[model samples]
Target: MSAHGETPHGAQGGHGNLNQLMAGFALAALLTIVPFALVMGEVEINRTALIATIMGLGGLQILVHLIWFLHVNRSAEEGWTLAATIFAVLILVIVLAGSLWVMKNMNENMMPMHDMEHHMQMEQMKSLQSQQG
Candidate 1:
């Protein structure tokens, strides 16, 4: 009712908002920079470990953005936003898994490098013999 005509539900003592935002920003930056450093080999982690760590950090950053910037919480919209987020995550997982499955199948069915080179050489020989004849 403070001149804005809308009720503020969870207004903490005035200074908390700025502090929360700064903390979220710092965490997001740390999440981002650490992953990049791991990727660049500055942390000396195995490729598998690095990938896992990066993905974990990415999930944390997503949560930070959702909770802090987007302000999506249990109280927001009677929890419809959280439901939608879960659905979206489900869809993303299905699509990514299907894509990886298809790519792996395609790779398994593809000709090996030696076979491709041999095929190319055979085609070239055929072309040269046809030209000579």
Candidate 2:
């Protein structure tokens, strides 16, 4: 009913108009470019600080993608989409941590090749002495 001959969107989630989409795109681009610039530039930033900054910016970019591009909102579907996303993240973390743990344990417990060879030789000597006796 407005000048554009289309109804205005409400609080409910829907596709964003051109202006809103442009704003979201700008914000997303800014978020991405800042961290990339920081990494690529020769500025003397502490390693820990740089990592934290990159992670924070990455998280913000994810939010921007979810809210703007994906049109995820809390109003329409009673937060089900948000809950599903959280669950998926949780499962992924658990799987990654478990895989890391298993890898670490295996690396720690595996014997050296030389040691295994010595063990096999000792077992064969013991068996031969028993057979001769």
Instruction: Give RMSD (Å) of candidate 1 vs. truth.
Output: 4.7
Instruction: Give lDDT per model, in order.
Output: 0.77, 0.80
**Predicted candidate 1 versus true structure: per-residue lDDT over 1-26, tens digit per residue:** 56665446435322247889999899
Q: Score candidate 1 by TM-score against the native.
A: 0.65
**Model 2 Cα lDDT, one tens digit per residue, 1-133:** 4576555654344487798899889999999999989988956989768867876787788778888888876765548988886777677658766876798799789998999999999999999999999
Task: Give the poorly placed runs of model 1, Cα more than 4 Å off.
Answer: 1-9, 12-16, 42-44, 99-115, 122-133
lDDT of 1: 0.77
Q: What CA RMSD would you report for each candidate? A: 4.7, 6.7
Native-to-model Cα distance after best TM-score fit, residue 87 in candidate 1, in Å: 1.6
Worst 10 residues of 1 by lDDT: 6-15
Please report, as a residue range, the 10-residue window in candidate 2 with the lowest summed lDDT: 5-14
